[model samples]
Target chain A: GAGVSQSPSNKVTEKGKDVELRCDPISGHTALYWYRQSLGQGLEFLIYFQGNSAPDKSGLPSDRFSAERTGGSVSTLTIQRTQQEDSAVYLCASSLGQGTKNIQYFGAGTRLSVL
Target chain B: DQQVKQNSPSLSVQEGRISILNCDYTNSMFDYFLWYKKYPAEGPTFLISISSIKDKNEDGRFTVFLNKSAKHLSLHIVPSQPGDSAVYFCAARPASYDKVIFGPGTSLSVIP
Candidate 1:
């Protein structure tokens, strides 16, 4: 792809329902990241995957929030039993590698609204 | 505690003037810092960055300054434009941390 891509540009789910957001990182990129932004809030790191290293989940807000990067290419963020506060925009990004430490390019993001 | 902090929630600057956004970090282990700008319905895009060793870095109309001793950094935009109106976030990466920590953000309104 020309740039990082995300699925379900917008989602509206009822409280307690489960929702999944997907991300397709740039080709050959070795690093991927997931973040969330509430209305008028800053981006919050959720998780990251670097090559084969164990996915970093240190930033996940709660047990209901989880993600997986299958085969080092695409990722899925799953939220179980979504709450009203879960309504926010989920953003995905990728980089060539930390060795370069360049800026991470971002996707437009998926707006999730928990009603 | 938030390692990175942007105290200002919003700022208004006249177009063609300079706009300064400030950021502070509590952790001393951070090795790099960056600024990202985001518009409505869009993802944040990288603006400028400064390494811990350097005091300043400039790219065209944008410049980033780092004060390691104070654990603070700032982004300055000269000749601000209306197109530059957006939310700005400060981010920090620790030497040992692979992920970057972001500040709450400061919304800048460049008025004409």
Candidate 2:
């Protein structure tokens, strides 16, 4: 695709339910990132993946929030027992690689609402 | 802690005038800064960027100025047009870090 792709542009789920968000980065891009943004708020880093190495999961808010990148092309972010606070837009971005000059391209984002 | 911040939540400017958006960061390790433009119900797109070594960078009608000593940066859009009315976000890439820190964003309104 021309740009990053995210699945299920909007998802509404009940509290305590597990929700999964997916992202398909631009072709051949080596780095992928996940971010979360609340209503009218700044983006919060969620996770990062570089090539085949272990993903940088330090930014995950809690253990319930986990992400896995398969084959370095697509990624899935799963939130177990979603909370009201988890209601936010999940954004996916990708860059060429780890460089200061490399700019990231973003997806339209998936708005997740936990009721 | 909020490393990157845009104090102004919104700004209004007349078309054909200059629109200035400011961003400040507490982390001194940031060496690369970028500005992004976003529209409602859409993704953000890259507008301009500046490195710490360069005090200013210009791309057509857009320019970014960086002040390393003050840990501040600003994006200037000359001859702002109605199409430029959108939320502008400031991002910084810290030294040796792959993730970029993003600001809350400032909504820019260009009126004709």
Candidate 3:
């Protein structure tokens, strides 16, 4: 693809329901990241993948949140028992690698609204 | 504690003037800083960046300044245009980490 792509531009889910967001990073991008921005808040890191393995999952808010990347390509973020507070924009980004070239390119993001 | 902080929630600037956005970080280990501009219904796009080794970096109308001793950095846009109106985010990457921590963001409105 020409750029990072995300699925389900907007989602409206009832509280306690589960939702899954997907990201297709730019081809050959070695690094992928997940982040969320709540109302009046900054982009909070959720997780990152270096290839197929995630070196950092410390940012995941709770066990209800889980993410995985396969074949060092597409990635999926799953949220279980979504709460009202979970309403926010979920963003995905990809990078060439670490160091000076690590400037990430982002997707438009999926807006999730928990009703 | 937030490793990155943008104190201003919003700013207004007249077109053709300069718009400045400030940011501070609590971590001394941050070695790289970046500025991103985001518009409504769009993803943030990288603007300018300064490495710890450099005190300043500029690209055309956008310039980023870093004060390592104070753990502060700022972005300046000269001759601001209405198209420049957007939310600006400051982000930092620790020397030992690949993840970049971001500030709350400052919304800049460049009025024509």
Q: Which candidate comes out best when scored by DockQ?
A: 3
Q: What lDDT tens digits, residue by residue, belong to model 3 across residues B1-112?
A: 8999999999999999999999999999899899999998888999988889999999999999999999999999998999999999999998776788889999999999
Give the Cα error of residue A81 in candidate 1, in Å.
Answer: 1.4
lDDT tens readout by residue for model 2, A1-115: 6899999899999999999999999998999999998888878888989888788887899999999999889999999999999999999999997754769899999999999
Determine which window of 10 residues in candidate 2 chain B has minimal summed lDDT.
B93-102
**Per-residue error at A71 for model 2, in Å?**
0.9
How displaced is residue A1 in candidate 2, in Å? Answer: 2.3
Label model 3 with its docking quality class.
high
Task: Tell me how each candidate scores on DockQ against the true complex.
Answer: 0.78, 0.77, 0.83
Candidate 2 at residue B20, lDDT? Answer: 97
Instruction: Give the per-residue lDDT digits (tens) of candidate 2, residues B23-59.
Output: 9999988989999898987778888898888999999
Per-prediction tally of clashes = 0, 0, 0
Please identify which of the two predictions, 1 or 2, would achieve the higher lDDT against the true structure.
1
TM-score of predicted chain B, candidate 1:
0.98
Give the runs in model 3 whose Cα sits over 4 Å from its true position. none
User: DockQ of candidate 1?
Assistant: 0.78
